[model samples]
Target: MADSGQALARRLRQLRQQQWPDTTVRQPQLARALNVSVPLISSWENESTPKVPPVSRLQTYALIFCTRRSIDGDQLVPLDETELTTEESRLRDKLLHELLDLRTVALSRTPAPGSAPANPWQFDDGNRIVIVCARLPDELLTRMPYVRPEDPDYIELYTYADLDSLFELHGHIRAFNPGGEVRRRTAKELEPDDLTSHLVLLGGVDWNDLTSDVFQVLDLPVRQVNDWGGDEGPYFSHGDRRFSPQLADGRLREDVALFYRGPNPYNARRTLTICNGMYGRGTLGVVRALTDSNFRDRNTAWLHERFGAEEAYALLSKVRVVRGQVITPDWTLDGLRLVEWPD
Candidate 1:
């Protein structure tokens, strides 16, 4: 009989094989995308009863595969709790509850500038919700078996940075008790704004130099931008950068900007510069560039080949100019609709 971990791995592998038959993905790459070590991925593929990736990691994966038209649009296939052995079910519930609690607490404390605050678990309903997070490569999302060729849901898939944004927003909402009630803000009320926003700096600082204020604001794991949402949440690197755009000579230049991927937020601003640039000229060139092999390969290479357009666009979309004077920063250049270039 297959153990639970084996069963889960087999199911996941089957789903990938069935959905992304032509795609070439490796264990190391998947491991990076999920922010776990390559050995862990190897264990999963080899049927070891590896610990489950955190809810946050799973959520990221679910979003990727679930949005594909092929997978029936269900990011997380609801498992039958009753079907699990009594002990297994209980353990699973326990883990889920722990994660939900951690997230709740993390989001409740008032964060100081550039830091994540302590988690607050003062709400009555904090125990009721189970939000599992996961991270998956864009290739997985695009190549999944049940996904559609052109799906809007897939287009809106979130990245580790985006998740960080949401996590920060959650913290802000928790601080305001927006409704003046304990932990009572709706999702809408948790939207990100300047006062409640955080800037994730990426490089050149010792982990020891990180301020409590930065930790409280981002609510991220110490020195890491990507973190899982469970008892055994794994930390992943989101290399130094954010997002930005530029326009010149009737061309739109898009970039995946960052500073550095490290354990400290103090250097986030230093490494934060436009890193990846996407250029577009005419409509045809822009469309082609969007799906160009060179562009995809180059961009994926920059991300250590663990992500694709799904993740790329998600990061690109979140870019907001915190403080700067740009001639054309709003996706348009001199009153012209900028086009997306290939590489």
Candidate 2:
């Protein structure tokens, strides 16, 4: 967020300086096209201390830069937006919209200086947080009913295997951290910027590649075994003991979940948290520990007390299911915590 202003300045300078190899657009030429003084243009381009230009000028800059006539001859020509062809209009709109977004961020980049607006899920810096979700395998999705376009139900999120966990975590994070930005991405669609911001990976190693990737680099004491179709079911292996789900009557009765928090290995300044379980119910259990209205306050407080300001910690807990509904696990309760870091 601190670089928002510099990003706007860099883009504007790139547009003016990179059009031609030998010649850069002089400030005077841009001033003539924008109908502004050269000194004002210089202020906008000054790298050491850049000034954000007005929106009207940004609109004209988009129009002129997208048009060939602006640089066809010897000078920058003023071109009206109405004169642009379809493709030119498309280009101009994209540039203008990007500039406007940058302007908004640069103008209000600084919020309260501390963690007043931040929750455990949100960052103190008020940066973006992306929740990466696991997508069902194509083979499984291809067989699920009601997913076909021709089907009457035609559920759009049928491909999402962890819908219950996604809905619970996404809404809960947004509600508690209203001042920060929150976004969602399927594992495959993760943007480059997402790796640098605060990230929350949902589901376990078998389905979520992001979770698998993080576990590979992070030095956590626990691991989620992903031996699908093996003799042993999925479980959380911590040191010497294996914590697997308890099944009765061919239905899950209790599940094992791992919740981890630490600074992101990719970007030390940002935080990385993973909520994973052997099954969806397990995932829901750990997420609701800090999001459930009845227990969130107590659960969150316990985490702060247990972990204190530690840079990293992992908690593996047992999630109980009562008549097919997942009951949120309280870390404070005895017998709920199976294993934990900093023990």
Candidate 3:
């Protein structure tokens, strides 16, 4: 059985690598996308870890590698299924069922965003929902999945968490109006007027320009931009305290994400939310922070009951991410403290 599982693991790894043959897909990247741990991804591909991923995750793998319709309506060649063998066909069917079965997904989908409790931050159909994503330079293309094909010069690759955040917010906005307009823009392209809309910045400063821009005004305890000589971050600084992706002993620290939700500095009438991290795992960690019920409730309650939007804007908070999820045993949104803004 283990040998068969190893064969299956190899096939899974092969299929995953085939999606971006020219690019290097690291285990941490896959883990961040699938909302699993790096060790799990390593184990799945290692074939000797004595552990196997669940069928639901295998379905996610298929979605990432097999499904392709183009998010931008650009036509692409479909995966050739006619040549699949009987076993291959059966496996494909199983993956699909695991992903689409209502009974399996009902519990997770039922809550939805923008429902009964109501979104306290003041969003309406009239206001546009702008999703700002980070655009990496051309030099980094070899490490990311291809997002936009037309832009051959700069391959705008977004982590699974970035796409996941976009869809999650889109769903929440669409719940208010099915025909609601949700626009996507890069941080580099953001303008003064764009800040007037309800905004969501997808990635942190390292990859997203918008997040970098927003951090300037908020002055959070953790910042992505700083003058640290030769070192670079999704870096965070609070007075004399500084934390980087590297630990004090020189070993790389586990990823951590900074989540901010409050008012937009450019326009007080609109709200701005940031789900970003120092790295891809940190980025996914921020996404998990926003989506997790415990964090969401505390944050939501704090937004609604503790203080107004602008006050919340002045303060910032952080959550530690171990794998791809937020560590929330003692996490509370109300626990966020104020960021001492310069006069």
Candidate 4:
């Protein structure tokens, strides 16, 4: 992505210099002539910005360059002065803008922070945002069955419902860090230090090994039994409250999910997030909690009060799904617990 920006920047700068070899065309001068921000011109020349200028801005730059180079008194160069046809110019500008847009999308996936990291969801430019997805094993898939009747293949990378919520959440994050580098990796590919960046781990212990390792080692609220997914069935431990689909409760509750945010396990300086559940509905529940505006608002309110400015915390909740959609009305915030990382 940076390569594209660099190439474009090189071409733009080269044109400016070639058009006026004797004169020293400073960035400020070009910015003033084009009526754009000096910083924007600097970004284009230095390749510092993740995205190139928009098509309109590029056109304005060309006009300014042509006006600066004209021998006659006419400020604007006529279309006939250039050998290129009107259609050819339009086609070239369209392709250039498309390339810039593609570069912007690619950069948006990474963490791009300036100075300090304020929001856990947003990061600095050039930083990595690693989203670790779970790939379930065949044996584990056979053992832990999904409570949602419609759910299929627990071991799959991600279900459509999960992707729906994830895609929405990712889009929001991209808005803040358009130049950041985003990546997706499986549990098997992750190293200890890989957790040091802005990390988001999807799925639960039964499928996501990272979740299993964290809960087991950190003494977090969520717990897994040895006979988990067996006759006793999968469940999560939260102090005196134990949430499980097998608990035989009269309530219409069908699944449980966990959402955690905190410092990375390997490096406390970075951020990590966990969105997982005992079943597919539960996973979808976590995704909804992150993306759905109403759901996120309620959860954020609960978090602010419960955690009280803490940097790390966990959210344990349950959701009911009917016909492939999580019923938000039936959702409940079971537990909002703070995480005490080891010093």
Candidate 5:
């Protein structure tokens, strides 16, 4: 006989704002610690229309608020459950059960709408994912007959910036996410729905407009130091440290590639991932890093180990081109990382 939604909303708000007496746990700090967006936290605490967070997210809330240890530092870091003291563990259990009971009542009264989105690039939830690729430059398009509108035998394949990167990444993504629909589009061609769905951007800021657009919105310190991943310029930079391609004898020996995975700024329910490089080879290397048969498993395992359940992170690495072949980057190996987020 109670307004369960309002009760749940009030309790969730109390856990964040009221529970922390000495240290005020701000929404932004809590969101980062919980691996969600600032807006998402607001949604849950909204007075009028509160959205029920997922059970897993509720569990994170319990872990974080159970002990002040999680917010001991300037920023909220993850609290390991195993390290929780006796009192903290008991308190966490009490908080978790209280939230769970309210969540159950709220769900029965008004069921949460829509299918929950899976992790970025994971299609197990049967959601649509859009891969946005950069278009080839005008100079290069001039040489490809299919790209010319007036050409009699035009196929339009030349419109894509990096065919190798597209081909390798598209297939790999589709195969990995059999339950979902995976679609590819040029940066300039994304539909409105595509923008809200999981977005995978390939290539660099110079060519892909979406890549540049995304970088501007994210609060990351890393950025495109140089527009073009030319022979001498660094593709991305963090502070003063630059990640540039290594070249010798006018040949690209190693190229810099960035692999970024985070909550979509457009739609927090979905994810946004960027596999990019200064050159085509570097982009291809990033794609192959997680798709390569020999190394994909190891690289993926390392990713889970390094970041855990934290959804947002970035990796800058060296993409070595050996004898014209792109060598899959082994992320677990030493000295490969140029700059990694949340270090």
Candidate 6:
């Protein structure tokens, strides 16, 4: 007798054949239709005992299949409740526990930080506050206040001031140097405009050796959220631009040079190095050489032709080279210059 998995697989194949009698359904097309990965469908086809999909995903698959069949306006018709219950029982008893065990083992293999106390927001007293804009990590989420994506409280704030300050605080929390100075300057800049508004710091900060000066410098009265702990949603990579740190072997250094050189090198050489020399080291020099005024201007036309303004902006933000120093453009460049060779 064929096992349940084989039966399910045969049934699925039959359903597909009945639905699309003339056409051969490809794995990718089926995966898309089912809202699942191609590997999953492949597994179902090959495995002796195929794992049943989660209830939510199964519902989606049923809906998609039903819609394709043009039955009941996008609703799955003729679903046997008894069959579903039996499958669900098998999945819960046989598959779920095993899958969960594997997942637990995988999670356990990774290094994790100390657990925060339950209810991190209990410290918030409507005084100093930090609002987090990024997704929170699961480990950190247990400590904080987080409304779900569909919740009415879910709000995405992206004003320059909010983002700038949030980014600055994020730097402080992550010990991001450039972000620290940016945070300080941001606090100073915003203080005058919003004096009455209590300082609300969002995102994590390094608590070790943290002094009142750090808080005072940023004008204290801050609220903080460390979403790195995982209370937030998924991490989204919105831009196509990629960033690679310069490795000591100098191969990565050459990579940076190639990016700057592009199609024409000699004609595009107007360079303005923006470095927090104390923090950024020599990476800014590399970026300046690559994105100098001449290169920027030339690239502008190319970028316009290739991508829209929003895309360009996203690319630029993603191209950022983060460093340890906290120097600004107004400061002298000598501090940040790498070893100078004899001219």
Query: Residue 134 lDDT in model 2?
Result: 83
* Count of clashes in candidate 6: 30
TM-score of each: 0.21, 0.63, 0.49, 0.51, 0.63, 0.20
lDDT of candidate model 6 versus the reference: 0.31
Lowest lDDT 10-residue stretch of candidate 1: 271-280
> Which of the two candidates, 1 or 3, achieves a greater lDDT against the reference?
3
- Considering summed lDDT, which 10 consecutive residues are worst modelled in model 5? 111-120
The lDDT values for all models are: 0.31, 0.79, 0.54, 0.58, 0.79, 0.31
- Number of clashing pairs per prediction, in order: 52, 0, 0, 14, 0, 30
Which of 1 and 4 is the better model by TM-score?
4
Residue 81 Cα positional deviation in candidate 1, in Å, after optimal superposition: 26
lDDT for model 2? 0.79
Candidate 3 runs further than 4 Å off: 1-117, 120-122, 142-161, 176-179, 191-193, 218-222, 225-234, 245-253, 293-295, 303-305, 308-311, 314-318, 322-330, 333-343
- What range of 10 consecutive residues in model 3 has the weakest lDDT sum? 69-78
lDDT of 3 by residue, 145-190 (tens): 6555755654443522366556555555566445556777777777
Shift in Å, residue 76, candidate 3: 68
Local accuracy of candidate 6 as per-residue lDDT tens digits, 1-343? 1354454455555544564466455666667656668888766564365543443343344433443332334333434334345544444334323322222222223313542111111122232222222233335544544334455665333212224334433433233122221222222233432222222222123221112123233322222222334644112121332222343443222111111111111112111011111112222422332234323222332222223222101111112233433122111112222221110
Comparing 5 and 6 by lDDT, which wins?
A: 5
List model 5 lDDT by residue over 1-343, tens digit each: 2387778889988888888677678898888888889999999888688887766677788888888788766788757888999999899878876775576556556633542222234565578889899888788877766677787887766799878888887887787788789898998888989999988999888889999999899987587767444555665778887777877888999998989988989999888899988888999998888777666644664565567567799999999998878889977554687887778
In model 2, the worst 10-residue window by lDDT is 110-119
TM-score for candidate 5: 0.63
Superposed on all Cα atoms, model 5 deviates from the true structure by an RMSD in Å of 13.6
